[model samples]
Target: MSDTQNMLNDFRWIMDVVQNIDVGLVLLDKNFNIQMWNSFMQNHSATLAEEAIGQLLFNLFPEIDEQWFRRKTQSVYILKNSAFTTWEQRPYLFRFENYRPITGKAEFMYQNSTFIPIQGLNGEIGSICIIIYDVTEQAINNLELEKANNQLEIISKTDGLTGLLNRKSWENLLETEFQREAR
Candidate 1:
C-alpha cells in the first residue's frame, strides 16, 4: 500500500460510521503515556495525538488522581481490571462533556470508559488500550425513558400521592436506615 493510503488505513475505521461518533479512543503504554490518540480524542481532549505522545500520566492532566494512576499502571503492567470514577466518583478524569477552561470548548461526552491490556510480541502486556464510548445522550438523558412496568414491581397497594409504602415502604425504609445508622 502507498504511504498516504497506509497512513489513512492506520485509522480509517472511523469512516465506517455515518454520523460521526462523539466517542474517543486512546492507546496508552504501560506507564499510561499516550501512544495513539484518534481524531475524536484530539478534538475532545483538546490535545492532538502527536503533541501528547511520550508524556507521563501525571504530566498529561493533574486532575487525574494519584489513585487512578497507581491502579492504571498496575493494570497495564500486571493484567488486572481497574474501574474508573465517571460521573459520581471522579468527573474531571473523563473531561469529555466539557471543554478545557483554557480552550473554552466542549468536545464530546462519554459516559463509559474501559481500559484493556495490550499484549506485546512476547505475549506479555506491553500497553493498555483506553476505549472511551460516548453514551451521555443514551445514558443520562434517556435514563428514565426505558423504564418499563415489568422492571419495577407494581405497588397497587401503595399510596399514589407519595409513591411511598403506605405502610410496607415506610417500614422497609425506616428499618434499613435505622439499621444502617445503628451499625
Candidate 2:
C-alpha cells in the first residue's frame, strides 16, 4: 500500500478507538463550539454526534456554570497546558444519570474532567479537548466512609449510660466556653 493509504488506515484505527472509549471525549473550538463528540459523550449526554457538532457547549448544557467553565478552558487556551477538576469541587460537568450498577447510590454520575489544549498544525492553540471520567463509585465510597467515621466519633464522645458527653469531651467543651467568656 502507498504511504498515504497507510496513514489513512492508521488514522481510522485511532478514531475508532477514541469513539468507543468509556470516557466521554469532547473537542471544542476556542469559541466553545463543539468540533467532535465521541460515542461515550453521545450516550451519556443523549446527544448525537451530528447534532452536537457546531453547537456551543454552554448552549446545549445551560446547567453548566458558565463563568467557572470559561475560566477553566481559558487557562488551557492561555497557557497551552492541561487543567484538572475533581468531582468534589464541581460534581459533574454534564448532568448524566449515574447508571453504574455499583455506584447507583448517587442520583447523578460524579465526574472528574481534564481540559487540555489542542494544538493546531501551525503550532498554536486551536481548541480544547475535555476528557470525562466516571468517578461515582469512588465518591460514593468516600462519602460512606466519612459518615461512618463521624458516627464513631460521636459514639466515642458520649457516655453510654447517661447519654451525656464523656469526661474528656465535656472538659474540652467547658474549656472552649471558658475561653469565650474570658474573651
Candidate 3:
C-alpha cells in the first residue's frame, strides 16, 4: 500500500474511535455554531450530526445557559487552556435523561465536561472541543452517601426511642453554652 493509503486508513480509524466513544464530543466554532457532534451526543440528545452541524448551540438546547456557556468557552479561546466542570459544580451542560438502569433514581444525567481549545494550523485558537462524561453513577452514589451520613449524625445525637437529644448532645450543648458564658 502507498503512503497516502496508510494515512487514509489511520484517519478512518481515528474518526471511528471519535464517533463511537462512550463520551460525548462536540466541536464548536467561535460563533458557537456546532461543527461536529459525535455518536454519543446523537444518542443522548436525539440530534443527528447532520442536523446539529452549522446550527447555533443555544438554539438547539435552549435549556443551556447561553451566557454561562459563552463565558466558559471565551476563557478557553482567550487562554488557549482547558477548563473543566464537574457534576458537583454544574450537574450537566445538556439536560440528558438518565437511562442507565443502575442510576434509574436520577431524573437527569450528571455530567463532567471539559472545554478544550483547538488551535488551527496557523497557531491560532479557532474552535473549542467540549467533551462530556456521564457521571450519574458517581454523583448518585455521593449524594446517597451524604444523605446516609446526615441520618447517622442525627441518629448519633438523638434518642432512638423518644426522638429527642441524647445525653451526649445535652452535655455538648451545655459545654458550648458554658464557654460562651465564660467569654
Candidate 4:
C-alpha cells in the first residue's frame, strides 16, 4: 500500500478505539460547545453524537452547575495542564443512570473525570477533552465498608443485650471525665 493509505488506515484505527472505549470522551471548544461525543457517552446519556455536537454543554445537561464547570475548565485553559476530579470530590458531571448489575445499589453512576487541554497548531490551547470513567463499583464498595465499620464500632462499645455502654466503654468515659476534671 502507499504511504497515504497507511496513514488513512492508522487514523481509522484510532477513531475506532476512541469510539469503542468503555470510558466517556467529550471534546468541547472554548465556548463549551460539544465537538465530539463518543459511544460511551451516547449509551449512558441516550444522546446521539449528531445531536450533541455543536450544542452547548450546559444546555444539554442542565444538572451540571455551569459556574462550577467553568471554574474547573478555566485553569486547564490558562495553564494548559490537566485537571482531575475524583468521585469523592464530585460524584458525576452527567447524572447517568447506573445500569451495571453488580452496582445496582447505586442510583447514579459515580465518575472520576480528567480535563485535558488540547493545543492547536499555533501552540495555543483551543479545546478541552473531558474523560469520564465509571467508578460506581468502587464508590459503592467504599460506602458499604464505611457503614460496616461504623456498625462494628457501635457494637464494640455497646452491650449486646441491654443496648447500653459496655464496661470498657464506661471505664474509658470515666477516665476521660477524670482527666478533664483534673485539668
Candidate 5:
C-alpha cells in the first residue's frame, strides 16, 4: 500500500478507537463550540454527534453552572495545561444518567473530568479536549463507607440498649469539658 493510504488507515483506526471508548470524549474550540463528540457522549446524552457539533457547550448543557465551568475551561486555555474537576466539586457536567446496575443508587452519573489544552501547529492554544469519566461507583462506595464508619464510631461510643454514651465515653467528654471550663 502507498504511504498516504497507510496513513489514512491509521487515522481511521484511531478514530474508531476514540469513538468506541467507554468514557465521554469531547473536543471544543476556543469559542466553546463542540468540534467532536464521541459515541459515549451520544449514548449517554441521547444526542447525536451531528446535533451536538458546532453548538456551544453551555448551549447544549444549559443546566451547567456556566460561570464555574467557563472559568475552569478558561483556566485550561490561559494556563495551557490540564485542569480537573471531580463529582464532589461539581457533579456531572451534562446530567447523564448512571446506567451501571451496581451503581444504580445514583440518579445521575458522577463525573470526574479533565480539561486538556490542545496546542495548535503554531504552538498556540487552539482547542480543549474534555474527558469525562463516570465515577458513580467510586463516589457511592465512598459515601456508603463514610456512613458505615460513622455508625461504627457511634456504636463504639454509645450503649446499644440505652442509645446513650457509654461510661468511658461519658467520662472522657466530661474530663475534656472540665478541662476546657477550668482553662
Candidate 6:
C-alpha cells in the first residue's frame, strides 16, 4: 500500500481499538444518536452492534429514564465537562458485573458511568463518549458508611420519647436547606 493508504489503514485500526475496548463504551453524535456501541455494551445489553449503531437512544431503549438522561446530556452541552453517576444513582441504565470471568461471583454488580463531550479540531462540537466501570463493591461500602453515620446522627441528636432531632440537628438541616434555596 502507498504511504497515504497505510496511514488511513492505521487510523481505522486505532478507531477499532477504541470500540473493542473491554468496557461499556458508546459514542453519540452531537444530536445524541448512537455513533458507536462497543462489543462489551452489546453483549451486556443483548443488543447487536449493527442494530444499535446510528440509532437514536431514546428510540432504542425506551425504558431509559428521560429526566436522568436529560440532565446529564444538558451538562455535556452546557458545562462541557464529564458527568459521573454511581451505581446507586441509577443501576438500570447499564448492567454491571463486579466479578472476574474465571473466579468471581455472578451476583456481585456495580458500576460508575461517565459522559464526555467531544469537540472537533476546528473548535466545533462533534460527539460524546459514554463509559461505564464496575464499582459495585465500592458502592456497598459507601452505603455501610452512610448507615453508620445515620446511627451516629440519631444518637447525637435525639429526644428520648418523641424520637426527634433534639431541636439541634433539625435546626441545622432546615437552616442549611433554607440557606441553599435562598441562594
Best by TM-score: 4
For model 5, state the Cα shift of residue 40 in Å.
Answer: 0.8
Task: Provide the lowest-lDDT 10-residue window in model 1.
Answer: 83-92
- In model 2, the runs with Cα more than 4 Å from the true position are 101-103, 160-162, 167-183
lDDT of 3 by residue, 129-175 (tens): 99999988899899999999999999999999999999999999999
- Show where candidate 3 strays beyond 4 Å: 101-103
- The lDDT of each candidate is 0.63, 0.93, 0.95, 0.96, 0.91, 0.78
lDDT, candidate 1, 30-63, per-residue tens: 6668787777777776787678788775687676
Model 5 alpha-carbon drift over 4 Å, by segment: 101-103, 178-183
| Per-residue lDDT of model 4, residues 30-51, tens digit only | 9999999999999999999999
Q: Pick the candidate with the highest lDDT.
A: 4
Residues forming the 10-long window of minimal summed lDDT in candidate 3:
97-106
Candidate 3 local Cα displacement, residue 97, angstroms? 0.4
Q: What is the lDDT of residue 63 in candidate 2?
A: 88
Residue 59 in candidate 1 has what lDDT? 81
Q: Candidate order by lDDT, highest to lowest?
A: 4, 3, 2, 5, 6, 1
Stronger candidate by lDDT (2 vs 3): 3
TM-score per model over all chains: 0.57, 0.87, 0.95, 0.95, 0.91, 0.65
- Compare candidates 1 and 4 on lDDT and give the better one: 4
Better of 4 and 5 by lDDT: 4
Deviation in angstroms for 97 in model 6?
8.1
TM-score of structure candidate 3: 0.95
Candidate 5 lDDT by residue in tens digits, 1-183: 999999999999999999999999999998889999999999999999999999998889898887887888888888898999898888878898767776299889899999999999999999999999988889989989999999999999999999989998989999999999999
